[model samples]
Target: MTQLKNLLGFLWYVAHKFQRDRCMQSASSLTTTTLFALVPLVTISINLFSLFPEFVKVSQAVRNFLLANMLPDSASRIIGVYMNQFSSHASQLTYAGLALLVITVFSLVITVDHTFNAIWGTAPRRSWPSRLLIYAVLILVGPLLLGLGLWGTSLVVSTSMGWAGEGAQATHSALKVLSLLILASGLALAYYKVPGRPVKGRHALLGGALAALVFELMKNGFTLFITHFSTYTLVYGAFAAFPIFLLWIHLS
Candidate 1:
């Protein structure tokens, strides 16, 4: 009983610490920067995937998985239309335009760096060259790694379905679990690396686990709220994406 009480007290303290870190403020700042950066980021990502013929299918699969996980079914269609519209024009942008796009993407990266620094109470940020190099690696390498992982997972699911016949549902459940674990791992890495300071692996992992759990709850809770109680849909209609996106980010 005493151990249980101690654990509960510790959890409450961590929760309070997270609140004190001003998560809403950071999340709002990210949301704003991300909105500006979204077009360029998606454009660049799709362009990169287009370079490899094998990645085409994987990219689409990964995209579908993300949309399904991130938004409710009704909201997904609306968001998809907007994404398609932007992507149609992405290829026509000039080199100068693309450069600006890269800058906007980097702006979001810098914001993330600052937010992590604040969370960890770190100081003396990395120099510009080092920062740019690290951000470049994250921008270029991160998606490819994620794509490969999704491709491999899809392949396994498909193979399992062929052999077991009744494993499709089970495979889906397994994939959801895998996705949570991956999210946690990625968050752990970010918590460890983004502050530009040494962070304990255990501390990073704990933060990651907490973030992953909150993320899952956020998705489900948002979907439920939007489906049942959202006035944004009725009031904003096609513009519903704006408020929905903001609300989601604020909650993050």
Candidate 2:
């Protein structure tokens, strides 16, 4: 237990220090890494389009809001193309998706490796055999982990919906609450999983919860911003808005 505590402490230390450099070095790497890392996430996006109009609606609202508020005057032309990346759902994980995933993971791994290198203040060096082993693990394990997570999330929702009584119906009303947790969990995992580090479970959970909280708050805040503050002219301007959103995420 003590050892676990120490490990958690160390993870927190690295993450805490990360916040300082996030907008500077770490965030920059993370932003680049995440764009690549998350291309795979879009594989699910296509299926999602058929199932959830609500999600696309909310996402567009967010996009429209951000485009208006944050982007500058010069970037308006590229808004349609840029927003497409966020909204895109290809029919299959074509060569392009696979290519994007490969590049993304490669970039993500390198960023993490450097982040760990900085954190431990050690030379960013590894034996080729060891490096290959790690690479093998990531390739094999990453898909399994992601699939497992999706399955687990599905089970949770299933179990909750199984409740049949009147009191349980009230509990059913809180399905979104479960979604809240899952979203946060996703964020924490993203934080833990993105970098080169092998984060402990406790630290991963903690970080995920925090990330989720921040994301939720931003969701509502951004929602409010869109509904009240955003206008047609400002919303359509892509150049100014996209970078600001990227910058904000980098900070996160």
lDDT of 2 at 123: 52
RMSD for each of the candidates: 2.5, 9.4
Supply the global lDDT for candidate 2. 0.54
By lDDT, who's the top model here? 1
Q: Estimate each model's TM-score.
A: 0.87, 0.48
Question: Considering summed lDDT, which 10 consecutive residues are worst modelled in model 2?
Answer: 68-77
lDDT of each: 0.78, 0.54
Best by TM-score: 1
Work out how many backbone clashes candidate 2 has: 7
Candidate 2: which pairs clash?
Answer: 68-234, 71-240, 71-241, 72-240, 75-239, 112-196, 188-208
